[model samples]
Target: MSLFPEDIASAARAIIADYAGKAWMIATAESCTGGLIAGALTDVPGSSAVVDRGFVTYTNEAKMDLIGVQPEVLAQYGAVSRQTALQMAAGALRRSRAHVSVAVTGIAGPGGGSDEKPVGLVHLAARCRDGRLLHREMRYGDLGRDGIRLATVKTALEMLAELG
Candidate 1:
């Protein structure tokens, strides 16, 4: 059995199939979801042709070092903000050979909730080398860590498909 939910697995398969048809490759930059977004895509057979690389930037330093997320942006808007997500997507595209990229940054928590940025809040961004970009802010409200991360993965995959 697949580790991901059926819906997620199905979406991943569709993304790989569609992108592969166009001879396009994909890259992922993840934070709160860890590498689940990449994991989902790589789970599908033949994904080797479609997936280029994945960056699990769980820390501020990793974001900057691995994907080139600017330190100023992270300081100004924090890691989970739209700015960071956008930079991450752009950075993934710049850093990889992939034709498209998706990025996710968020607070998936049981204890990290604050009045302003609560648990289950996620920001996602996707970019295409053709100059297309997309962003989504999801407020999944306290669905617990695993739930929030999985939800982010699903949405990230959807964004990638949209870009493709």
Candidate 2:
């Protein structure tokens, strides 16, 4: 199952309430969760005041083109690595008018497991306008695609809240 809209919106509401008229805007760069992180935030009423834009950079090329993720980073650390996550967050902030940015890159699967990077491994990064950056690495251990994605959305939103 996907994320419940109400649950997602509830979290989003806190962010909306906090940032509205505070001159804060948010942006998202998503990978394994697609655009779900942005979707959840948009579900809340009055989110327009806080949400700037979202980039669904599902492919390495898209990450590089849409958000300015360095191709060398993708080649060296892979898309799901911490370096890429940091770059994604920075890229989102650079490419948008948002004051804070959150980025999600992960492998949520039953097929993408490996000795190094297993399934359900996610790297999340949040960057604030003041240059504070936060990174969290989650290993949900085969929570299935939807479960992992939903958790990612929740965590990404929470990070945005922290940044705000």
Candidate 3:
């Protein structure tokens, strides 16, 4: 019995398998989900052909320093904002030699709920081919810390699949 959702993992495996023949590379800038997306991708055999790197920028400082999330953006929109997500993806794309990049930042928490940003609020961004960035936001609605992170990872993998 695996701890992760079997079907999502299977789908991720399929996605990577489909892209394995081509010279595709994936880079991840993660926050709420840590490195779960990268874990799922690397689970597949020979994922080195596709997974180039993963950036686990779990803190505001890390998001800024590692993935180039600017201080102004962090101050203006906060660390978990969409603007930060986009910057994180762009930074990952810039830092790594990968063809595609995905960034996730969020408050996957048991208690970090406010009127504007709630516990399950997540922001995701992807940059594909020449630094074009796309964003997604989801309020996962109090699914606990681990649950929200897992959900974010699942969605990130699916978004990566869409890149194919």
Candidate 4:
């Protein structure tokens, strides 16, 4: 069986096939889902033709440094906000050779949740080189850490496919 769930694997396969047909490459910027989105994409054979790289920016500093997320954006909106997700997607596309990019940031945990920003609240964004952008806010309740991360991965993959 594939290491990724069937939905994720199938989504990854579709992305590879579609992007490869168009000679497009994909990049991922991940936080709460870690590199799982990229891992799922790369799991498909011949993904190298469509996937350029993935950045696991689990920290604010990493997000700023690796993907050029503005320090001001992180400070004003925190790492898990839509502003940050958009910047992450744009930055990934700017830094990589990829023609499309997806970004995710969120709190996935049994702890670290506040009334305003609860656990399982995720922000995802996708950008295409032609300036197409998409964003989604997912409130998955308290699905624990693993569940939240997996859900984020699934959503991120779908965003990539949508952008592709």
What is the overall TM-score of model 2 with all chains considered together? 0.95
Instruction: Quote the lDDT for 127 in model 1.
Output: 94
Model 4 agreement with the true structure over 44-154: per-residue lDDT tens digits: 999989889999999999999999999999889999899999999999999999999999999998998899999999999999989899999999999989999999999
The lDDT of each candidate is: 0.93, 0.90, 0.86, 0.93
Supply candidate 4's per-residue lDDT for 85. 97
Stretches of model 3 off by over 4 angstroms after superposition: 1-3
Better of 3 and 4 by lDDT: 4
Off by over 4 Å in 2: 1-6
Error of 1 at 128 (Å): 0.3
| TM-scores vs. true structure, each candidate | 0.98, 0.95, 0.94, 0.98
Per-residue alpha-carbon lDDT of model 2 for 1-164, expressed as tens digits?
Answer: 22465667788878888888687999999999999988887777777888999999999999999999999999999999999999999999999999999999999997877989999899999999899999999998898999899989888888888877
Clash count, predicted structure 1: 0
Per-residue lDDT tens digits of candidate 3, residues 7-95? 66786687688767667788999988889888888888788888999999988999878878899999999988989999999999989
Across residues 1-164, which tens digit of lDDT does each residue of candidate 1 receive? 67899999999999999999999999999999989989999999999999999999999999999999899999899998999999999999999999999999999998877888999989999999999999999999998899999999989988988888
Root-mean-square deviation of Cα positions for candidate 2 versus the true structure, in angstroms: 2.0
The C-alpha RMSD of each candidate to the native structure, in angstroms, is 0.7, 2.0, 1.5, 0.7
